[model samples]
Target: MGKRDVDDDDDDDGGKRRKASGGFSDHAPPDDGQSAEIQLDQMLAGGAGLAGLGMGMPGMGMPGMGMPGMGMPTPGLSVPGASAAPELDPLKPATTPMDFSKLGANMPSQEFPVPRDMVEYLMTPEHRQILLEETGCDVDWAPDESKVQLKGSAEQIRKAQRLLQRVLMHCNWGRSEAKVRRLLKPKIIESAVLRLSPMNTLPAGQKTLSQTQPVISIGKDKKANDIVIPAAIVSRQHCVLELDIDRGAIYVIDCSTNGTFLNGLRLPPKTTGKVLVSHGDELLLQDPANDQEFGYVVNIQELNVREQTKLQAPRRLLSTEESATMGRDFQ
Candidate 1:
């Protein structure tokens, strides 16, 4: 090649090499590299939010990795996939309760211990009506009130027994100390309700779990849930309510594709974890941004008159230090 052509070729190669290195230091010192990694490890130590990491870095804005509350999913939360719910199987039962029994089910007769102290409850018109009509049991309480003999089919007897047990449990018959038990009376029924407000096609009403009904499933599919809310946004098995009578509490679990909201908080869909619910907490069966969902207003009957009074009792404001400490504790 001519001298000029060779000179041009060498100049081009030099420029290419310089550009490949980006005109900066091509290698970091071993110590400097280690220090940079340590700093990065510290930043990711919590594995929650990438604190102190500027957004200028590529991919730093990823959900659950970048700064929290920036459209980021919470750490450890399973971001729901953009997929449709599974189709309902045509062979499944039409209603949740029907899955357990066929039409017109009746069990053999049975006996159970129904405390005499709560016998007055059985005689109450409302309870009596339920026992006779629902369970088909005429519960004959022992004269001493130690036990009961329910004259009905087995299913009927079980139903009656469960009803009475709930009452006993509510009254703290076995849950309380002997002295407290004797002092307690069946005066107040510690209860709560999910009052479904009328909207779209849903009717106005309330659902109270009693007479042995502890858990009820909600959804649009008739075969899988006891409480069927026919909303286009509702999933086949939307959510579940677990009522704990002894503790006077209710737990809610969301298992929907759209969402289930409790007190304006969207519960993690399909999560096994349940949120403790109290009175006045609102549960929405659809995305809060949507207006077609039903809102169930929780109405928890006060557990105790003394506790109620204490809740309503006034209190002086805390000092600044105490307030700060309380805030930190909640955080």
Candidate 2:
């Protein structure tokens, strides 16, 4: 009986041991052959399990390799961000300077020097109209002055240049007593020549009046009047002869201290009015106290023969078509 009891006690103890082992195995993680707590304890104790971090391991970067300049470097692999970028301190300065020497000081200018007289002549509306008609180009003086600024096509510019050359060829001879006056006899809308016997002792003296020369002051004052009669009876600014292009009529205004007689009618001096004059009218710039045949006779000519000039009424005028005619004349 004693032998039997001892054998039963040993059987119970073995069963209890097997049951505890079964409970432990049921709660264990399948991934790790060891329990997590045991492995954590072994890692903390620096056992072989610490090798999982790959410290000092070959071909492993960062974690396995050592840090640069910290007594640690990656095994057979370079550290990133170190010596990757090129040196930014440039070997030479990046700068460019203007080479003004390339701008040759000896280059010829495209602009031609225009005389001041020619510039003034070309700038006038009358001459500009002529230029437009002849060359179909618009021209102006440069702000720099005395430079012709022509605006047009190349062909038109050439034509303008030719016309300018012709004018320049004669402009120099304007004052000289040359017979080249008939070279370019521009058509006049309405113009007149004043004929007068200076003092009944001399032949008839004449003065041409056109749009360009619309007003002519006749008196003894050489500086004030265009036609200086130098007569003892005449005043400084005795009378003015004005041509009306729009009206195609001419007027005579008396500015003389001595009475001026127009067809025997005395005109009010310095008045704001003008007297209409015709081809046959007469002007006596002397006091009525003395009778004199020495006076002016108006001779108005319509070079534009088509537009008949009416002395009685103001008539609207138009530019007549340019007629090519040649004759010797004076400026």
Q: RMSD of each candidate?
A: 33.6, 23.1
Pairing residues by index, what is the TM-score of model 2? 0.34
Residue pairs in collision within model 1: 107-153, 107-154, 107-155, 108-153, 108-154
Candidate 1 error regions (>4 Å): 1-193, 199-201, 302-331
Specify the poorest-scoring 10-residue window by lDDT in model 2.
Answer: 322-331
Could you tell me the C-alpha RMSD of candidate 2 in Å? 23.1
Query: Model 1, range 1-331, lDDT digits (tens) per residue?
Result: 4343122223644643222221112333355455544654554574523334443344445444343454454344333452444568899966654465543345354667765665554444554554566456776556465666677666666666655554454343122332122112222234445555544456454566643765667788889887687878888988877664543445577778887887666774332245555455667777667663466765654333212110111234556664432211000
For candidate 2, write residues 1-331 as lDDT tens digits.
2343122223644643222221122243446588655754564466432134343344433332233333244344333344543436677776678789855344322344567755545455665565566666666657357877676666667666665554555344231212112122233247666565444553355667677877777888889887777788888888887765654546667777776877666764444345555555667777545875657665665454233321221223322321111111111
Q: Any runs in candidate 2 off by more than 4 Å, and if so which?
A: 1-189, 197-199, 305-331
Per TM-score, the best of the predicted structures is 2
The pairs that clash in candidate 2 are 66-72, 66-73
